[model samples]
Target: MRIVIALGGNAMLQRGQPLEAAIQRENIRKAAEVIARVAKDHEVILTHGNGPQVGLLALQNAAYDKVSPYPLDVLGAETAGMIGYMMEQELYNQMPGAQIATMVTQTLVDNNDPAFQDPTKFVGPVYGKEEAEALAAEKNWSIKADGEYFRRVVPSPLPKSIIEVEMVKKLSEMGALVICSGGGGVPVRKLEDGKLEGVEAVVDKDLTAALLAEQMGADALVIMTDVAAVCVNFGQPDQKKIHKASVQGIGELDFPAGSMGPKIDSCAQFVEKGGRFAAIGSLYDVEKIVTGEAGTWITNEVEGISFYEKKEEAAVA
Candidate 1:
């Protein structure tokens, strides 16, 4: 089976964990173990988010003051290479004989995309409103409210095409595990004359992954994030975890736009476009996810939305 696995950046670098090199590598190492197992029996194409990494790089770049902070496109490419190298090394260690490659991909977007007018994608560290506003003034950054805190936000355009998608498919057809399109492939826009230039915006990785899967004719799109499953009434007493849903079933639901929304939309788009299935679950559960033993699976095979039984809370000590 052919699968495209989208790794959530926050999942790879666990929330609240320090953005240290060794820590990130260890996390990727753990992820590689599961991916290696999946790659053993089936073809795998990998894409990962660079949210945390890119934000950290931007912070570091801003501090240097030697040159203006590098644009988001450049930082996105750096994160792709940085994260891909770690994943490549770890995967190679697990499977010395397997073919693996990482490409610096580009996702083409339109300059006129409405997303530019609305910067909703969050990046960088959260700060108090006062501090955030000050930084925004200093850096010419757009700041937005994220929960009680504020953070940098950027344009996140819809993906029109992946510039190197054919090569990605060709490499995968040749039996290679290809990792590409980190941070939505360094968001680029093509000029009227057909030249491409990096745009100063981020592209949603989940949407880009769906586009990639569609173009590659993948059998399944598996989005591996930190969450165990997609939930409705999340964090409320009546919370329910979706285990299975038909394409239309999942489409009717609501999820947080910055987080699960893109994931849900991506899965629905893939299945609706005739992919066999699309799944969402923890990165650690790939083994179970493939067999439909775990995770939220979206397909037309199911009649309506079905949810996993509520897990009982642990007894208090």
Candidate 2:
């Protein structure tokens, strides 16, 4: 089956880990092993998040007084190239002789998207509220709460189309495990002359992945995150894992704007648009997720929503 897997940023950098090359590659090496296993039996198109990577570049650029900091579009492209290179190399190492291609894709967004007025996407490393505020003040950045900590935020416009859709699709048809649309494909908008210009915002990768998957006519759209399943009342004592859900049923729940919200919304959109499967779960267990052994599966095949029993609850029963 053709599958589009959107790898969350945390899969590589993880929370609280230093953004070092060795560390990122090591994490990717492990990820490649998992992906290699799945690729052996299916056609896979990969997309990845760049929340931490781009933020680190922005920070580094700010530190250098040589010139003005690079634009988010440029930073996003650099991250796509850098991260794509790493991922491709690792995948090649894991699956010798396997075909793989990574492209610096461009995603089209509205020049006047309301998201420009509302900076909601979180980027950069997490920091305490005080530290985030200090950085925001010094850097003239927008800051917002990311769970308990805070981080920089920028406009996250919705993707309207992919500029390189035909090429990406062609590559996939040729049996390559293609990686494109990193950090939402370097957000851009069309000019009056039909030319495209880069935008200052970041497009959410999950949304782009969904759009890509739909356009590619893939059978499944899988969002691989750090969590085992989508949870309701997250981080609370009564939190429950969603084991299965219908597109409409799962779309009604709430999730954090910067984190799980896009994942849930993207998956729902895919399944609602006639996709056979949409899932959310840990990247390490992607094989199980695709096979229905684990994670929260969202589809029209289910009647409604169902929750996984807590270990204690199941044991007692």
Candidate 3:
């Protein structure tokens, strides 16, 4: 089986803990154990989230005025290389004889995307409201109050194409565990002269993973997050964990954009585009998720459809 696994940010950080390099490396080592197990049975293409890492890079840049500040797109690419290296090293340590490949992927987005005009995607570090206001004034950044803290917002452009999709596919097929499209790919725009220019935006990793799944003809797009499964009424008294659902059923559930929303949307998009299945589950339970013993499985079938339906009827059912 060919699987595209999108690694969540918390997969590299422990909750309510300081983001120390040593802790991050240990976290990645644990994640690699799960990934190495999956790679043994299936062709795996790995992508990861860089929300915390990129934010730390930006903070480092702010502390040093003598050096040039790296843009988000460049930082995204850097995190891809940085995190990919960590994943590669850990996986190599766990599976000594297996080969691993990491590619610095670039994803194309429209230059004229409306998101460029209205940056709503959050990035960088969280700060107190007073500090946020001061930084907003000093940098002219679009700052928003997120619950008790504030963070910088950036444009989240839709991913049009993965520039290295074919290369990633070929590597995966050649018995190599491939890591690419880190931080939802470095967002870029194609110029009129046929050159690709980096843009100041972040593409959602789950959405990019789904796009890659479609392009690579993947059997499953498994999103491994902090949660065991996607839940309805999340964090509420009436919260319900979803084990399995049709793509249509998922669309009707209420999920927040910054949380479980993009994940459900990505799964639905993959199923609608002809992929067989998509799953959402905890990073620690990946082996079980792949074996169909866990995770919220999203299929193309409707909730009430009968298995005895005619072949032609099932096509449109």
Candidate 4:
């Protein structure tokens, strides 16, 4: 089966860890192992998030007093290339003689998207409340509380189309393990003159991955992340893992917009558009996720065992 796997940012680097090249590469190596395993059986296309990476670049650029900070578009491209390079190299080491290609993809977004007005995407490292407030004031940045620490937020527009999807599909069909759409394809917009221009916004990677799956006619989308499964009332006593669910059932649980919500919504969108299945689970368990042994599976069909139902059955027995 042809599969598209979207790697979450947290999967690439843990929160609060120092931004170091060696550390990030080690993390990529681990992720690459799992990806290489899946690629052995299926034609695989990879996409990944770069929120923390891009934001760190922006912060570094701000320190240069002679020139203005680079726009998000340029930073986004840099991240795609940087992250793609590491991922490609590591995957190659794991699966020697396999054809792997990393394309710097472009994703088109609406210039007038409401997301521009409300920047809610978090980026960069976390900071103490006081430090976050100070930076927000100095940089004119939008700040939001992320768990125990605060981070910067930016507009996250929805991706309308993958600009280089045709070529990506061609590569995938030819048996190449392709990686594209880093940081949601660099977030571009169409101009009145029929030219594409970069925009100052972030695009959600998970949504773009779903779009890629739909366009490529992939059988399933596997979202590899830090968590093992999608849960209801996460972090509470009543929290229940959702082993399998229909699109409508996943919607009833309120996932945080900054985190799991996009993954759930993306899976639902894929299934709604006639894709066979979507799974979200720990990156370490990619095999199980693909085989439906682990993780949260979302489908249009409502018949199947759910985690909650299994718990009830065990209780009765």
Candidate 5:
């Protein structure tokens, strides 16, 4: 089967972990091990989150008074290149004979997207309430609470189209493990005269991943994040993990906007747009997740849902 795997930021850099090159490389190495296993059986295309990395670049540029900070589009490109290299190298180490390639693809977004007016996507390093407040006031920047810490917020517009999608398709068809669309393909917009220009926005990675999957005619779309499964009543004591759900069923429940919400929404969009099923789960559980052994699988089948607990009981019987 052909699979499009979207790696969440946690797959590369853990929350609260320093963004050191060594730390990121080690994490990618671990992730590559799992991905290599999947590549052995399935044709794969990879994409990943770049919130932490882009934010770090923005912060670093902000500190250097010698030059103006580059726009988010450029930073997105930089992170794509940076992260893609590490992922490609690590994947090569894990699967020596496999052909792995990375591309800094481009995704177009509407210049007039409402996201520009409402910059809700969080980025950069997390800061304490007090520090975040101070920074927001001093820098005149939009800020938002991310878990216990606060970070800068940016517009996360929906991806309209992937510019280099054909190339990606060509590479994957030839059985190459291709990694592209880092930071959602460096957000761009088309001008009136047919020229393309970069935008100051972030394109949600999961949404772009769905677009990639649809374009590639993939059999499965797996979103690998830090969480083991998608849970309902997430923080409550009675919270339950959803093993399998119809796309429509998953849509009926509400999830936090900042975290898992976009992932579920993107997955639903994929199945609705003619892709097979989509799975949301941990990177560590990737092989099982894509195979329907783990994660919250969202499908378009008539049967509503199948709970993992029940499946396990049936096996025991």
Candidate 6:
């Protein structure tokens, strides 16, 4: 099977944890064990989130006065390389014979996207109200309250196209386990002359992963997140996990924009665009999830067993 896997940021870095190289490397090693098993049977293409890493870079810049601060797009690319190196090294150790490659992917976005005018996507470290106001004044950063803490905000534009789609597809066909389109692919815009220019925005990683899956004709798009399944009323007492759902059915559920919302949308979009299936689950259980033992599978049909269910049923029958 050909699969495109999108790894979540928090899955790599936990809440209130120190941002240390050792911690990140260990996390990748754990994730790679799961990925290595999948690569044994599937043509795997990996993508990952860079929210925490890029935010760390931003914070580092804030602390240093001598160095020039990098833009979000550039920072996204940097994290892609940094994380990709870690993933490559770990995956190589775990899956010795597999050929792994990382691409600095570029995703196209419209120049006039409304998100450009109104930056609402949060990035970087959380802060108190007083600290937020102080940083806003000193660095001219846009700050927004996230639950109880404040965070830096940036534009989150829609992903229109994947510039390296053909290259990615070709590499996959050649039996290469590829990692590309990290952090929604360094959001860029194409000029009239056909030159691509980087923008000061972040593209939703789920959306970009879906696009990559579609473009590469992937059999499945497995979104590895912190949660095992899509839940209704997330974090509330009434919260319930959905084991299987259709594209339309997921749309009916209430999901927050900054959380489980985009993931559901990405799965729905993939299925709607003629893709086979999309799975959402925890990174730790990726092998089990892919083998039909865990995760929520979203598909177009609702009458029969889900993809995972059908696989298990077939195996038993």
Pairs that collide, model 3: none
lDDT of candidate 1 over 94-207, digit per residue (tens): 999888999999999999999999998887667788999999999888998877878899999999999999999999999999999988898999898999999999899999
Residue 72 shift from truth in candidate 2, angstroms? 0.7
Instruction: Give one digit per residue, the lDDT tens place, for model 5 in 81-193.
Output: 99999999999999998889999999999998989999998888889999999989987889999988899999999999999999999998888999999978899999999
For model 6, how does the per-residue alpha-carbon lDDT over 43-133 read when each residue is reduced to its tens digit? 9999998877888898886788797777788989999999999999899999887789999999999999999888877777678899999
Higher-TM-score candidate of 1 and 5: 5
Backbone clashes, candidate 6: 0
Deviation of model 1 at 56, angstroms: 1.7
Question: Where does candidate 2 stray beyond 4 Å?
Answer: 311-317
Specify the highest-lDDT model's number.
Answer: 2
Worst 10 residues of 1 by lDDT: 308-317
lDDT of 6: 0.84
- Quote each prediction's TM-score: 0.94, 0.96, 0.91, 0.95, 0.96, 0.91
- Output the worst ten-in-a-row residue range by lDDT, candidate 2: 308-317
Model 2 / residue 192 / CA error / Å: 1.0
Query: Which regions in candidate 1 have their CA more than 4 angstroms from the true location?
Result: 128-130, 147-149, 311-317
Per-residue accuracy of model 3 over 70-103 as CA lDDT, tens digit each: 8889999888999999999999999998989999
Model 6 misplaced stretches (Cα beyond 4 Å):
303-317
Winner by TM-score between candidate 5 and candidate 3: 5
Which order, best to worst by lDDT? 2, 5, 4, 1, 3, 6
List runs of model 5 lying over 4 Å from the truth.
Answer: 310-317
lDDT of 2 by residue, 1-317 (tens): 99999999877899989989899999999999999999999999999999999999998988899898889999999999999999999999999998899999999999889999999998999999899989898888999988788989999999999999899999998888999999989999999999999999999999999999998999999999888888889878898888889987887787877678888899988888879989999888799889987788999999779988777223212
Residue clash pairs of candidate 4: none
* Cα lDDT, model 4, residue 85: 98
